[model samples]
Target: MLNLAPELAERGIAINAIAPGGTATDMAAEHTASYTPPALRDVPPEPVIQSMNALGRLAEPDEIATVTAFLLSSDASYITGATIDAAGGWI
Candidate 1:
């Protein structure tokens, strides 16, 4: 992703990657707690997701989108290869 960034920059373009730490994707639910699966079970999905995060909150999918917007914005003109960790601080 970094290499392409420079090439794309030739045209005054910017590039970045968004790494969502841990989210409750259906694919991730296949595994159980033994795998430390990201999704929560019967414990009420809302807050349990929060406790798993370092910030004590779960990240709604759109939250990541917001960060992506910022990175693609002129405000981040000097930024590249940056990662928007929109997992609500999940580790």
Candidate 2:
């Protein structure tokens, strides 16, 4: 995106990306149910996974989508060649 954004901007096209972390999706639930670390073998994975971010919770799909919508909207007219972090403050 970084490389293409500049060239695309010349044609009035915007290119950007969103890095979402720990979203509360079906895939996330499946992965949490199946994976367990050696040290945390006996521990439940949900809390451990949630603790990976500063918010202590997974983001809803709409939360990430909101960011995406903004980037594609006129509100973000000046934004380009950038990656928005919609990670719930993941560490």
Candidate 3:
């Protein structure tokens, strides 16, 4: 994305990336159930997962999509060659 953004910007194109952290989704639920670390194995998933981020909770799907929408909209016309951290302050 970094390499292509500059070249694409010359043609009036905007390119960016969204790096989302843990989100409360079906896929996340399944992954957590199967892959939780041993230290957190016995603990309840909600609190343990929420505590992984500074925001104390996972992000909503729309929250991440909103950032993508903005980048695609004229509101972010000046934004390019960047990665938006939509991670809810994941640690």
Candidate lDDT values, in order: 0.69, 0.87, 0.86
Ranking by TM-score: 3, 2, 1
For residue 13, give model 1's deviation from the true position in Å: 1.3
Q: What CA root-mean-square deviation does each model show from the true structure?
A: 4.4, 2.3, 2.1
lDDT per residue for candidate 3 within 1-91, as digits (tens), equals 9899989999998888889988889998888878877887788766866678888888989998898889888899899999999887888
lDDT of 1: 0.69
Candidate 2 per-residue C-alpha lDDT over 29-59 given as tens digits, one digit per residue, 9 for 90 to 100 = 7786678566766777568767798888889
User: Which has the higher TM-score value, candidate number 1 or candidate number 2?
Assistant: 2
Q: Name every residue pair that clashes in candidate 1.
A: 50-57
RMSD of 2: 2.3
**Candidate 2, after superposition: displacement of residue 58 in Å?**
0.4
Could you tell me the lDDT of residue 36 within candidate 1?
50
TM-score of candidate 3 relative to the true fold: 0.85
What TM-score, over all chains together, does every model reach?
0.63, 0.85, 0.85
Off by over 4 Å in 1: 22-41, 45-51
Q: Model 1, range 3-78, lDDT digits (tens) per residue? A: 8888888888887888785655556555445465445344555575566778775455677777878897888999
